[model samples]
Target chain A: MATADSTSPCTEYIHIAYPVSPIDRVTWVDLPDALWHEILRFSAVQDLVRMERVCKKFNIQLDRKDRSHGAQEQGREREREREREQEQLSSIHDLWKTHCQHRWNDKPRYKLTDEREDWLRRHYDEHFATVDYGDTAGGATGRATGRATGSRTESSHVMMGNAAPFPVANTASSSPSTTSTPSLSKFSWKKTYFWMEQELARTTLTYDELESLDWYFNFTPLAGGRGKDTLLRCIFRHGLLSIGGAGFPSLPYRMLFLHPGDNPDIFSEQQVNATDQHSDTDTTTDATTDTETHDNPIFHGGIDTSQARRHNQEQAVLIADFPLHYVSRLHDSGEWLMTNAHVTFVSTDEAGALTYKDRNFQ
Target chain B: MADEGNGIIRLRSSDGKVFELTESAAEISELLKDSPREEDDEVTEIDIVRVASPCLEKVVEFMKHYDEEKMKEIPTPLGGSTFNEVMDQPWYQDFVSDEKMNRDMLFNMLSAANFLGIKPLLDLTCLKVTFQITGKNAEEIRELLRLPELTPEEEAKAREEHSWIFEEA
Candidate 1:
């Protein structure tokens, strides 16, 4: 890609020997170091690391180290110059901070006691432990069986593993710098950012696949024992679901009310309408409703004669009772992705029936 | 020279090629806008000794057609696989993707843009460069940038130190 043939029109300009510099032909490398820095600032962390390995110039440029052996007479001046260079290199903290802010904007903020510690790297290390929860020994087998059978049991195992207290000692063992000072200069935020991207990529399931599964079952038992609010908060805190804000449709409430034997399809449709009524009602009463719904054995019981009758009736109401606007709004939003779906509920009339506006749809 | 009545600004390139642009267009470049003009003279002329003619002409073309609102903001850590994917506007993509805009020309345009203090042009050019480097491996990057090969010892050291980065995902 770099070699330009003589026949190319670009060669016409290169061949012209400007009197100012005879031996040196202007090339990309000849651009000012500052301009190179500006261009490199646009590169992703992975690209930056790869670019650093391109050549010594890039290596030295990125490292910002002066390796020239100056005369002994200028020793003091060179020492001061090196100190300035060190200061400039350390200022890369601002760049990493920008990167962290952009990538994890929704993440909660924590106070740093030591200003010099590499926050981006440290965060990556900490978050890596939390996200890497289920994939240790039987994770592959669990995911495979879950995919084949859509088994709630397999998925619950993964969720149970997620609910286990984060191994604090694991953080120390995973990050070598925990014992060291973690000096900003030697630590590469670019590498940490690259690893973080890879981790996110690994954890992300295709929206369709996640939606098809009994996702509610993943947290149903936990939600029952821990209470819905704490479970919901834990899901957000653990970064298990990538969706942002409280506007994540009604998946949490749906999960809270659902049980092992309940037909998810029926509840999903019922909850879609229930979500409308739930949003309009006082949100403070949700905790009370949550307990009431869980206590009702009708939800936990397997499909029986009465349950089938109720399902048919609810299904009929869902099909016939949905307003024209609600149907249109549902069409506007693409498929409902259980993992990353964000829907804005808007009350359309004085009757307080709810419809959602999906930002992704627009 | 800029024709005062016609609102034309004249920019002389290093190779003695002169390009004329409207005052509004020329104002995109902070260097030309801030350049001192002889008050007694009827025309305004700026000398860009660092920028060659070809690069200057492209720079003039960019400034002439530049639109702040129309230009889509290129996201950082560019998520797109292709330049066209990253920038939806065909005009900006076509301008940079021109066959004549070789590696040398591209870098020269970047230099000219930086030298003339045209921030938008600079950013566009830099984004294009970033797109070129994205998703390429170390060896591919070295070849793309025409960088010299490191010694075996140095290569081994680099591999050892950053072994995790070198591993394929």
Candidate 2:
């Protein structure tokens, strides 16, 4: 009935019987590396990051596993991704083709200025051999570029009129080399453009390129351009050219200048959101024209003479609409803006009142 | 291979304590299964010198339930619980948490199971230890295992890297 603390004899017996703490007698550091790896294999992937922090040894083991996985599996993932991107591009190209045919049936050709001519000559001439091949042997240039060199290609289209009113089928396929490299390489033009603008102190862009650049200047309707659909302009903005073309230099300068980089929503939901946003903004501006929104009405309603005039007006409004909002924002800023597209951040006020969507939009 | 002629096998532990088990029981360990027989009449003595006497005894005791035919049928711990609920089974709870068997002895049992190539026992021991450490905070685990304290920077980095997991907690 006596407690050890109260009795001297009992306290002495307890002290002699238990010489050390139970935990002190047990060492767990002796567990082998194989056991650790087995445990890791069974652990959830989400737990790997935590397991890595256990010790330097664990960190090494986890990182080694990751590196081994990243090698072959990542390559397979990229292959699948490339195939998916190609499919998306082909579908978009179909949409683009349909849009172009309907909009530009009676479109006027782009008028070339001396400055614009020099600009276009420098960039496009080397790839298509536009000046030399269009004039001399179109089939020779087509064969050299691995195109259908028989008779009709981008060069042949150029040869037909030097300034074709509409972008032909071959122009879309042959202008941008799709099988060359991946999407990352297409943006190398930005690096090159910076060097030219900063070092050379001037731009010698062709008239077509200048016209492409102007496509970013005002808010233009996506489906309408005055007597011209600006197919070239649309291609660059939506990454139509960069979709399949890896190292293709056909990336227009306007795309580089105006791209809203890395909005995770951009390709899927944001694309829908952007189109919806465009329509919503347009509906507010032109309330009466909302019912006549379908620019390609020929594909819908039977041809009407009054509808023809409305279509032309819509094209002018479309071209005028595209660049105005973006240009005005830049103009209001009254200074040059440099964007990397990668390093984007959202900062909230101290009160934390804004939702994620609001802060993202801001 | 014939259970009728099979007799007791002698297992010599690291501390020289020998335990006798049926040849069928000894067959559970791959090490003893392939052990060369001196004679049909003589007892096959497998010197499992890597295992301590107490741990080897526990491993031998587990080998009784460890059916080699049903080796692949070790019950995987059911999910949703923090620790593998299989550790809570009556036999496992009593054996693994024995008064004399501290953390070191549990690990020794794990090492012995691994050495003997008795997979189910090895998994059982490993899962037992895994459960002990599973839900405990890093500091508690480090203290329990007598691990050296992490530097502030390492601790900070670990927290940052697994912040999602930490935030859930």
Give the best candidate by DockQ. Answer: 1
Score residue A15 of candidate 2 by CA lDDT: 19
Q: Which candidate is the best by TM-score?
A: 1
| Minimal lDDT window, size 10, model 2 chain A | A324-333
lDDT for residue A341 in candidate 1, whole number 0-100: 12
lDDT of 2 by residue, B10-37 (tens): 7766577888888787777776676655
lDDT of 2 by residue, A268-313 (tens): 2122223544544423233113223332223122122121111111
A14 in model 1: Cα distance from truth in Å?
30
Interface RMSD of 2: 17.3
Q: Interface RMSD, all models, one decimal each?
A: 9.9, 17.3
DockQ of each: 0.25, 0.06
lDDT of 1 by residue, B10-94 (tens): 7777676888887777777776676555555445565566677888899898888883334666677665767788888877888
Instruction: For model 1, report DockQ.
Output: 0.25
Q: Tell me the RMSD of model 2 versus the true structure.
A: 24.2
Off by over 4 Å in 1: A1-25, A61-97, A109-188, A191-362, B1-6, B40-42, B67-70, B77-79, B164-169
